[model samples]
Target: MTPAPIDIPDEIRAQVYVHALAAFPAECCGYLVGARAGVVDAVVACTNAQDQGAHPTHPERGADTGFVIAGAELLAFARAFDGDRPPRVVYHSHTNGRAYFSSVDQDLASGPAYPVQHLVVGVADGRVTEAALFAWSDNAYVEVARWQGPREGGSTA
Candidate 1:
């Protein structure tokens, strides 16, 4: 059965927006850790190895349009599931001001390689404009929750 949507606290959401802004013009990738199912309490920012020519199939693409979590970070993510606080959501940012899963995202998540939801942050002009959380349902990932606004004093944007 499909699982319920994961819960990301406002402060955690703000942290994600900050990460997105910090990586502005380049997509940022990471994951959210939770003590139990359906809730996330921490955000672990990972390196976007896209520009480093680390993307398996599309190394030519820049981080501004793509992102890939590789090397040690990827290994850590893999090992997290066996820990007490596993990741519940994997998140990334889009340089364009739009928070929707792209074809590349679909391809990477086809098998869901990991048992986690996805959060996409839409950042443009060095600020977060919107964000969306997606979960696998039916035969595809669908948006389960969304937020909008700019970064200011720990808010859900």
Candidate 2:
């Protein structure tokens, strides 16, 4: 059976958008940490680390176009929570296209290794355009929720 979808608070949602917008030319990378039942109370904006070679899977995408949580930084983030509040979601933005889980996202997520909701914020031409939340279940990545922002030259999907 499928698990129930997570309900992200409006404040958290707005923060994600703001982070995405701030990242702009590069992808924004971060985590949502909280104590409640999947309602994120805080947003932690982590280093992109893409230029830092955090991910070897897709070097072509580099820092300006890609994102990585990084090794030491991931551990740091884990320690940052330290049983007080667990990581509820791993969030990043697609700076060049629409929000969807790319192959790189899958490799980074690693089939339940980084088990949590994965949120992708889409930014194109320097505008916050869309968002989607993906969850892993039954050994596959599936979208659990979605949100679209006002798009340039198009309608919100």
At residue 100, candidate 2 shows an lDDT of 89
Clashes by residue pair, model 2: none
Name the weakest run of 10 consecutive residues (lDDT summed) in model 1. 55-64
Assess the local accuracy of residue 38 in candidate 2 as a C-alpha lDDT between 0 and 100: 52
For each of the candidates, give the backbone clash count: 0, 0
Least accurate 10 contiguous residues by lDDT in model 2: 57-66
Report the lDDT tens digits of candidate 2 across residue range 33-75.
8884757788988888775543456533543344677788788
- TM-scores for every candidate against the unseen true structure: 0.85, 0.81
- Residues 5-99 of candidate 1 have per-residue lDDT tens digits of 79899999999988988976667899999897656899999998875554435422443355688999999998999999998899998876789
TM-score (C-alpha, index-matched) for candidate 2:
0.81
Model 2, 94: alpha-carbon shift in Å? 0.3
Q: Runs in model 1 with CA error above 4 Å?
A: 1-3, 54-65, 151-157
